[model samples]
Target: MWVRVTILGRCLTDGQLALYRIPRTKITYSNIKYDWGGWIMVGLESECGNGKRKSGGCQARCAADGATARVTAWTHTGIVVCASLALVIGAPARAGTDDAAGNAKAARAPVKPVTGRKKPAQAAAPATPPAQPGAAAPATVSRAWSAGPGTAPAPSAGGAVSPEVAKMIKFAAFDKLSMKGWITTVPPAAESIFQDPNGLRTALAEYGIGYVAYSTNTFTANMLNNAPPKPQTYQGQIPTTYSFSEVTVSYDLGRLGLTGGQLSVGTMLTGTTWEPLGPSGAKFANLYYFQSLMEDTVQLQAGVFYNAQNYLGLLVAASMATGPQALVPYELGLSRQGVPAPGANFMINLPNNFYNKAGVQRSISPDGADVEQQANPIGLGLSSPDAKALFIDEFGYKTFSSPAQGSVWVRAGGLYNTSPYFDFSAGRKTDTNWGFYAAADVQVSQISSAPYEAYQGYYVGGFYMTSDPNKNMYQNYYEGRVYGMGIIPGRPMDQTALIFGYTTLSKSALDFQAALTGIRPFGDYASVTVSNSFRLNPGVYLMLGTSYNVHPSATPRLKNSLNFMASLTTAF
Candidate 1:
């Protein structure tokens, strides 16, 4: 067990004066008595009370008499010590083994008492102006096992687990484990009380396993619609909700003697309350896959997964009002999350922050938009027989891993689908179908320090994509965006973004829309979206946004539509 001592007159932020881990054999009744010192040390110890001079056990002198001593301990049984039991455990004289010279050296160590406490006059006025109403103080973890008395652990890009999983209750050696936020009697700030009821969630983290689960539910309503009555409504004025939940489990292959290897699998559940939501069914976001890294220079992944999971990822454009329009060129028929096809990815990490990645995945049928999703909701079966293979490649320069120096990512990629399709406008069959896209994002301004918030800043980026107009309904796509996080004075976890996008529709797509609605379709479409997200708690977030669509394709009679949307995402 380890004992932490606090000197009553001092005000250490963590309230720790010294910490000592002592073995069981060195303990003595007299040693315990003097070490505790009646809850305070009055003066230098002249004797060990055992009538012998001992180097170990609490041996300290106070500059003044009658100061207090406080001791706390974390024991083998996961119990924090009671004050009486703490005294019996005894605080060691100093760090290291019993030695007169070491104790003397520790005795002479200086204590730099905090000098920042306010004076009477200074205390009368606020040192810093107060925040406006509803403004929050930076969040602090109050659980005992948090990093410090009131400090939270560094934010991680991962999820949480229950305490029981940290150390199987029956194992004595593992029972004494010390982990941030894992041994606490109360739930950590990131988790709800009801999570991990069975203790199986975090059971393998100690063995190099990892787990993450989250749910994202979004509600959208089209407030205005202007179009000639149509066979299919344009998400017209009806509110709908999209719900997606997923859990992923990963293992470090080092545990099995394979260094630099990682294996992971993800299962997802999704549904929609009204209009079709993207990928609306239960499925495997990504099936079993193994990734290997070689000398930090080359990486490879094989098994069932999506091309989009490996390439063309962007943080600034991660959240949009409608879909992945600005971040992913879905029109190119590359495999995606929840409907990933079998594939392999190879990447070479180049010098000076450059990299190249290439992949090939089974392309899903493009005849009907939801044919593959309906036939393979589980994502384990083969893609449609009519579907062919899809090849994709990308090259990029990024500084995401070293953000303190600067933050920027520039990339370009192309995709080719080996499938036949008819020209959208000419009604001619074609076997050649391909597309190309380029994108870049750069952080223009800094917000908080890198540690407090690395990705919080003003970011600007643009994307342009072009495909074979002969066979694709959308000839070209363009988008520009500005994203900012932690911009508010006290809300380091808050974010705001604005995005603008445009798409040109082919004549055949317009003709089909005209046929369905009995009116000519709009020639093109443009939109602007604005959103703000707030971190309501450690692992929960709320986002509200709105989008204005000009020249909406479905309803050509009305020139525009206004839509509102909100989403809640929770992590566990």
Candidate 2:
């Protein structure tokens, strides 16, 4: 007997036949017999015949076809049953392996059956081994298993994140930023004294709520008065002290699903020991505000607040220079420092570091100190009948590269104050006042690579301001300064500044001064100031400086004067 047995229409190799103990018998006669545990008759044409005598070749063909069909069907049935059992038992174990390793990539790949696994609640489809098209028939055993419709799929250990979740994660990262960028330098202190010991501070920051508080005290004394028109005027040359303290709370609106939005509420307390410019008393300053940033290109702010630096002068606000050299001399009726009022401001960032900004703030009393006391005590008073509206706009360009690469800021702006002002020469009340100003600051030397050394580099800066001589006491103001940061080793947060200033007094002011003193000042006023500011720790700061003025006539009749000043600042 010649028996050619195959599974799935493909002949088995010799190894497979031997493993199954299937005999490989060959015979020339059609009638042949093979015996296993029981005597079995095969290749018997008569048994397969349908009541007709057939040829030997026909009989052989018929017998072979019948045997092949029976064997193939039986082999397929056995394979399917065995594969289903393996998949049902091994799925849980394979899922466990994938989850423990946290390999999302592996989990996505085609699954393979392995030994020792829990049976799935629902049965999977018959396994299908991978095979190439147009290749020999596949082996009966399969390794790949796929879950049926009712079967629950395994959860991912570490997998793809949704777009919404990714965006939120990114915003949270930027929400709780460190203040190192705003600080000229960060001290060596590990943490602030106000830091919460219970980790509540950090926890709140993560959720977008934060707190800040700081205080600054400044003192100035006129050391020498060259000429005193009135002997009683120079009686004490008493020292004057100005103090300002503020506390603020900020909340990120992103937690409420409004991205790039923030709400801040703050209050400032201000006082002065002596009166050179004030009704002087502790009063509340404007500090409540709402801010929104749109796609890093535009920003909007509105509330009872003030930001002078944003309107016109960057160098003057940032410089360590003190006294006259630091003054930009804009109209006082507009929004001035320590005199906050209701306002709205906007900024649009342009390409190549260019930007434009504008603002409208309610004008307060011209007297700086009186605004917070007599005019707007709680930053909400409108009792001052002299109050008007202030409009300001500016265009600027800036470059802020790495500390070692240097930075530059240049800007020009104008302000229009609707408040009435007395003409200096005519002594007549004017309807409105307007002025223009420009300022620039450039890093003049290479900087060091220190964590606290952001603006810590040599710098040169200047500012110019001009107004109508008839209406303004100072017709024109000019100031130039040079700054050095971290000049002393181990004090990377220290800064020193040398400043020079010139002011051309209006004719009316000169004439009025001459009438009172019986002598007219010859030339414009000039001042030279040198100052040093350094940080003692993360929360403490100190500044010391001396200023010499020539032909100083803004207030008391003085041909010349020398003044010394000091300031202390603490923050949390």
Candidate 3:
């Protein structure tokens, strides 16, 4: 028998099938008998048959024979009841074999047609496998992360920072600051040092020390003075003269958010010294007593400042003098010659434009020169010589700015001194004294574009200080103004100052008339200042400077002075 089968959605023909053996059943043919156990059937169809009968009753005869012979006929119709029952009850089913002579004929049998319907053209190809989870997606390179809302998500491991927090972080990094230091060099006589006229010459120093610390707040301290002057004439020299030395410490407390403005407190201690103008000048007297002059005097100062962002600022300060109170008498007595005499003076200063890119400053000090004498003059020597009280008032303005290639500064000020005891003695004891002083300084290459080592510059500055006639006692010859200018030039180790100066003293008489009345004496003075620095290495330096003053009125017309200094600084 030929058979067809379907497996895994595909049909298989008999040629592609494999044959197997099993137990066989009895069979009978029409009017023909065969052995009961090994009968074979031929020509089977797999489709269901139509209900139709042949005229000769072939189907019925075939069925009767199939029953009598106990043979099974494989067909599209139902099988015999007993045979189907036997097959279902576990009778082994088997394939039929064709006769060797009929095999070729059986292989040529036609296949039955499928009746009801046909199978689908083909089962759809197996679906593609689903994608796996956590797989990376395609990526694109970019210069910066996308900032659009809901576009690029923040890192999953951490939370996002708020805009305010991010802004604060940026500000902190940009606004942070630290402390720094600076060094300044000031020339001689640039600073005031109050000293006694009859004391030892201890106020002179070659170099001064400065300490500065700055951050948001700034602090500065300065100590400077000039070399004491030598004597010029015999009777014209005093046993002791007051030298001026000031130590000022200023603090900028503006950074504390106090907004109350900047505040500064400072104290100055000025010593007394006596040294004449030249070789022919007289020696100092009462040196021991003069040494205690500054010890008995104290100065107290307090100031408040207001600064605006537009490079403008204002300062108001009040200063008071207290101590032995006798130093005033000695200072007044020395006013007989030269500039206005130095003394224990009380002043109120108003400074403006303290710190700005333009560097402009203006100040006014209404000073009381004889406050101590008006109170007590016991320790000052001469006893109560109908002396008039003295007062000194000063007003000045200074401006410093960079212009193109260099820097320039101008300072103009006036001084007025008055004494109450104008005509105490022979009208010669006139009291009120006043004068004007002004100075201008310019730096040639301070704003140069070259490297600091190759930088070159020069400065020219001058000052004029004078006082009107004042007859308060003692001698009052040098009571007028003095004028001078100094020229500074060079860079690094090469620097010098060529100074031309002069002073005029009021008339004086040795015998009240001296065969000469209303006599005026004019004096000419000249000085040369040479300063040089040798840089031993990057961390070491040696500095030397000297000054020579020539007074033509004395026997020895040449006055020589010198100052030397050396220091080493290192950085890490």
Shift in Å, residue 457, candidate 3: 0.6
Ranking by lDDT: 1, 2, 3
Model 3 ranges with Cα > 4 A deviation: 1-263, 267-403, 421-428, 445-447, 450-456, 470-495, 508-546, 552-572
How would you encode candidate 2's per-residue C-alpha lDDT over 164-239 as one tens digit per residue?
A: 3232222222223221111012111122344443655455666666665667676766677445434322212446
lDDT (C-alpha) at residue 32 in model 2? 14
lDDT of 1 by residue, 376-479 (tens): 76877676755777888899887531123336678899988887766666555667578888988777776544222344567778877778766676667787
Q: 439 in model 2: Cα distance from truth in Å? A: 0.7
Candidate 2, residue 36: CA error in Å? Answer: 77
Identify the superior model by TM-score, candidate 1 or candidate 2: 1
TM-score of each: 0.64, 0.62, 0.33
TM-score, predicted candidate 3 vs. hidden true structure? 0.33
lDDT of 2 at 207: 61
User: Which candidate has the highest TM-score of all?
Assistant: 1
Candidate 2's error at 117, in angstroms? 40
Candidate 1 segments exceeding 4 Å error: 1-201, 225-237, 274-276, 314-328, 401-404, 426-428, 449-451, 507-519, 554-558
